[model samples]
Target chain A: MSQYIPRKLTRLPADYCFPAEGDVAAYLFSEEAVIAVEVALVTQRPLLVAGPPGCGKSRLAETVAAVLQWNFLHQTITSRSRVEQLTVDVDHLRRLNDAQRAARPEARTKARALERDEEYYNPGIFWWAFNPTSASRRGLPANVGRPRVAARCGGVVRRPDNQPQHTVLLIDEIDKAEPDLPNDLLEPLDRRSFGLPDGRTLTADPAQELLTIITTNRERELPQAFLRRCVSLLLREPERDGLIAIARVHEPKVAPELIERIADRMVELRQQRVDSGQRSPGTSEFLDAVRTCHDLAISVDSEKWQQVERATLLKPMVAQDEPSRRP
Target chain B: MSPAGGRRGEIHLGELISALAGLDCDDAAQAATIAACLGFGLRAPDLAATGAATPAIYDHNRALPPPAARRSAIPHPPGLALPASSPAVEALPAQIVPSQLASVGVLPSTDSSAAPAWLVAGYQRLASERSSPPRQTLFPERAARGVLTAALARWRPGDAGADLDLDALVRCIVRRRLPQCLPRLPSMTLDNGCQLLLDYSESMVPWWEDLRELARQVSGVLGAERTSIFDFAASPAGARRWRADREAIETWQPEPGRPILVATDFGIRGEPPCDLRGSGWPAFVDRCAARDCPLLILIPWSRFFWPKNLGLHPQLVHWHPATSAALLRRQRGLGHRTAR
Candidate 1:
């Protein structure tokens, strides 16, 4: 029988309405960012996003997952994060305890092999994503799905049912890990499969390609080999229109005139900082200022608004001091 | 298995056993027993005796006997089970530690903040010697060598000198004989051992390749073997070695005697100015002072906007393209005199 697959993937509308909950839903994607995401989906390649901190690099994956109704899994990369943590983590200690119990004649009742078998292996997100039946049976409260096992071996082993669903894995701040980490991911990423301790190869179904989104702050340069495999986009600081869209998404109730005024001021401030060789404020700061204005009920043209701007926008040291008085 | 075999081998075997145990190996108990029998030359009966003995025996035989006593017969081999106490195992020497081996540059001294009293005194002396106003001398080459030695020597501990505007003297001499100073570039020759560290941070991206080429050229001019090259970033821990080549540079700790040349844009973005109080500047300054190593900074930027007070050390030298050729010649002249 021929399997049914959707011909065309859903494209997000220019003014798509996001859900009331979650930061990612409220994110506004620029045209370039949208193109990058679309290219990644078509090619079944990971999207490598390079940008400054707080520039929506991490949220892009969440936004994609939400819009496409795919299972979303996120892992923050740290200096101590091991590659194995991303795939499957077997609890050797529990297995050892079970083994010790099995050796005792008096503990036979508690020494069942089932206690130490698959239960000892806490499946990582990739494991659940690859085996949809396992994911459905596990009954992730957040995900929308029902268990319909296609194949089963004993109570512990199962494969996905006929329904095809995708998974979006967000590897955030990948540059935080060791220098060789990106290179280490080459094999798993290229083949879309990784080896398990139990000799099973967890392969992503080719028909339902797993979507990977990698975000980096450029703290360290990623290996050229790894970068070549993924579609990349650099998210630059937004202009006035982009800023207004971002602010509006986060603060929907904000007056249009106030949003415009705040965006213009932010752009001017950023440009001023850059011209003076100072570190400019980013989108995060802009959002903070907008939120402050909204909560305090300050008008853009009011004297009280200037105080709020100084308190929120200017750094503590700068805010405390007055401009040099004439001699 | 003989107890008289290499102590190192036995220690490594013990470590392997402990590692396997930590991984909760299913056969860890059996592996540990076998390791004791073969590596420590303990018979099954001796293990039985130890297992039967009270906990007091474990405490009494805690420390492993010295390596020299490998040939001596002992009642127990102290390898019955992997020692739970960490101190019982011999600590690996710094030279052989895996982490130490992986790192390419000098591990900063533990006491980074406290510069030795002698080092401070030595710097004062060298600073004083070079502080003398450059007298109009007939022998500019001799004066240049004297300045170079003073600068290099002050980098070592137990030295003292006053501040001297040595840059002014170099400029004065170079400007006086402009035509004569413009000599053809010197051929490649071995220098007094020096390491060239380049800045390869994000801000340096545009100039990274060019700087690396310059470093390669500098390496060729100085004997390749004598000149070690490294790249560093303005990470939290001052600068760390950046590896670009397959062959790792030999691990070396900067010492008082060695000359360390750094080529950087000095435009470290995302970092406060080096002169700012409570910034990372003190940590950097202390690191250099702790080693008492001479530094020659090569900056590509214009002098009009250069950062000031890089460090208070007398041995520190800043050079730009406009003045580096003259400085290089002066350095080479010092080398020639030392050789003669």
Candidate 2:
């Protein structure tokens, strides 16, 4: 039997700003990238994206999640993350106890034993999504009882409620996580089902059609094994038009002239710094300058120009002195 | 050299100029007086009494005194007049402050057969093999970005020249030194340790499934387990999780013979804490551990940390196929622009 997932659910909260259609394909490699991702989704391949810092690597995942209306799961990596930390094990015993108390008060003793077993072998978030029972069909047979209820960090998923047929997993900054951690996902990610502890396998049969999107800042060399599994797409520093669109999104009140000035300056600064000594300002720095100028009501006069220029240029130059001097 | 040494040299030239210009007075007298004061090199030549003068003549008929032929503290004896027609050296630019010319000095000429003394000393260092690179002239934006990125790109092994923060470090390293030519690959390995864990499997599904039930159980268990267990979940769970991850707290070691971590490198200790140590562990360890196999899960924990600590991300250490191509394209464009 097929599971029912709520289709075309509105993802963005009411107050959130949706990306304007005109600017949708403006970012570098954005149009082709979206096409690449769409193809990956159709073919069921995890999308791997690589780029420099100012390049919008993370946004691809966010955009895919936004466009597809899939529930987005974002996990940022750190030096401290472990396996269980990323995909948590569920607390099955407590779930059974609560289920027992609410429904079958007469079978309290038997329910208690089940509760202990559940506690002993609780599944994590990975197990819940990987398990078939978690995504049980809409109409269950009478003997099965109400479908299993799984707990999660975001919210609980009632097995009886519509199972999320499509999920967009965004692994932002995958380069930061432990080198070995990425390879672990190969088997379960490929098989679309993971085995749980109680000899009960969690299978998303027909399966959880996951659109996995992994982003890396290209800070280090990724293992070849991980790179081979996914369709890799790269995001570069946006071109003039793309940058203008990005600036518009962030600073709605920004004047066209100011946006162009900032974009031009940013591109020039990045290019020169890289040429001078590999020292380019990031998008954040440019925006911060724009906001600062906006806040203080300052214009780029010769003196005040130094203020913005110093923030963007001189300081980074001084900081990067030795490197620039190198052969 | 003594600070007063230049004054000594100046006094001799001052007297000579005064004598040749025929403006003999206190300035000229003072040179003699100072010579007297310093003792030696003070005797005046008898030719001064006859007032014989010649306009900077260079032929053998009136050859000038070789500045090096005599070293009587000053280049010439105090009373002798220099040739009247000697060319006056125009005063150096006032803009060149003394401090700015701190390296000013004289060098002995190797080709003394033809070269002048001043030229020998002035051009020595400038012509030396080891002068610093010329200052770059870049547009402001280019200076800000390209120069900065290029500065970051220069980092080599053992150059710990910074105490930069995360943002500064990434701006310095990743953005600056990024290879201009990214490789053209059918596929490219991400050249970095910065990773992301996109858990697409719906975090909310587990949340909706069990939060109420878990909360109810916790509420009930509070009486039996006491508040301490729940407190454990609250207080140090994050920290404990971090520590446990490092300590391999969850690894199930059934017996003594099983190797937990394989490769051992004590030398890797001083590097960033995240640097992987036991890379070649047995596969049995993977089976035994409750955690996912370390190979498959990619998390971007190293983002700012690598740039801050190591200056460059580990992934970009080698050239991946596509990155090499991208870098090549960038470099080619740069080369063309430069050629023009």
Candidate 3:
């Protein structure tokens, strides 16, 4: 209630573990990231995150959600993603089916049920995100029989308690979406509300708390107008020491020397990738290399280590095409 | 998406300034400080403002410029069920047509050695999310983009001047060196970045809108971060842009290896001082040449109105509206005789 007790944090703690979410590894929010989150909360704007893939952009949202212990909802935007799908969609097919079925005499009792609009309503992420209680029941007020919660896709993160309220939302990989998608999000984000199909507006509760985190991989350029409205964050990939620290968190049992060596190797690979105009190795690749070496007992100096590096770090298109250089 | 949900289209930043003065900083420290200041001043507004002040919340249904219902296009062919995910791109072949496969000469292939060109191009179109639009510029848009990217006709690389050096690859193998990893072979890129200089002086009044549009188009081509913009009146030596890339009103100078695009008419309207022959204009071209920055001057006035006796220098193109690609090609020395 009332923006859910504004969480004004000075520094974002490193190596933060999510209680409700599973095995997210680490989210090392820098000082700027900390301020960005705070600014989003204060300004009531979406945090637009641009970064290399696997740079922990989504995790920032999840971590913030877990910290706030608010209801977490996420949508991974793809080429197929639509601005409408985030807010609400009517189950027209089901409604049509119900309409067809109402013609039968045996189904007379259920025929009148068609009059109930809730039967054909399906809430999108924004609905469940802003106010779950009404979204779960298709905008019907409470105390109506048990609310028919639509089966959620993978978007739902940690569920809230007996009282589920709106909070943090993660709109991941927005760049994968068409340019218009960001432009379309201007109002829903700005107003903290969107329009419903039934002509009713779904405004955030005066008490509702919401934090929107939108990530982009620079796959497509976002419109200038869209970028102007957001609290933008550019998350650069971590440095060598940062990578080593991340590796330790993801795989602690791996020997420090092995981690250091793999981290060093990843750094070298990244430089080559950048120079070659290829996608550079990210934290995810570094952790995978460290894990592979630790699991297989492949020493960095061992000839087999080259195979490991090729598999994890140097595995983009050009390198992938090369006949295995394994001796 | 609600069809009649809320007001739509672009919302200017000035109107939302109090809401959008967020950090545009690349430096983390600077961003943090900016955010802290915003947070501190967060409560200052409510405490200082009166009840007569307009509320920040943009209520859709009520007044405060009653949010106009956004007009949505009706899915046509009446009963045809189109997928909601249909992106805002042009009509394209949803599946690979065999007819497209044999058009070898028309459709050139990708530079990737891994696969055939047509297959890669088809696969890429199917995979990538995109939208489109372009304006008549000094450069030409391709039947498929990538055919003509350089702004000039006879182009020279300003920053990026490399192609895949197979020799470097061969040297690594010939030397029997399997050192850490494979040697890098950078693909050719046209430029390091694009820096645009605008003429905001009185002479440019008629073309002020054109100047702004040019900046947007260039930013649309090279990313906003890679594109820097400065506005000047009499000369570019004092042209100024926000210095966030490396702080405020920074002076214009040649960014080594970065191409410079200046949209100006030399303030030639009723003026002798602003002519291209003498004003700091020729000196500016020298600076760009010295820094290896290919300078392209886009003069709104056609070639006839262009000042006479101007010494030879940076390429100047007539920035005429609706200047066809064919004409631009001929001017750029890519005429029919040189075809192939």
Q: Candidate 2, which segments miss by more than 4 Å at Cα?
A: A1-29, A88-117, A120-150, A155-164, A308-327, B1-340
Best by TM-score: 3
Ranking by DockQ: 3, 2, 1
The digit string of per-residue lDDT tens for model 3 on A1-327 reads 111112364223433323234644445556556656766776666777767767888888877776665667788986446677888776654654566577678887777547667756677788777777677678775656643445353454555455546478899987655335676787788766787777888876656667889887764456666765666666778888888777766676889999988877788877866554355777887888888888989999999998988888877453433111110
TM-score of each: 0.46, 0.40, 0.51
Worst 10 residues of 3 chain B by lDDT: B47-56
Instruction: Give lDDT: candidate 3, residue A133.
Output: 66
lDDT for B90 (candidate 1): 82
- Leading candidate by DockQ: 3
Comparing 2 and 3 on DockQ, the stronger one: 3
Candidate 1 accuracy as lDDT: 0.53
Question: Model 2, B287-325: lDDT tens per residue?
Answer: 424332111111122222222222211122111112232
DockQ of each: 0.01, 0.01, 0.02
The alpha-carbon lDDT assigned to residue B158 of candidate 3 equals: 34
User: So what's the TM-score on candidate 1?
Assistant: 0.46
lDDT ranking, high to low: 3, 1, 2
Tell me the interface RMSD of model 2, in angstroms: 41.5
Model 3 spans > 4 angstroms off: A1-23, A142-166, A316-327, B1-340
Model 3 RMSD vs true structure = 29.0
lDDT by residue (A2-58, candidate 2, tens digit) is: 211112223422322355433233222243354346434543556777666656677
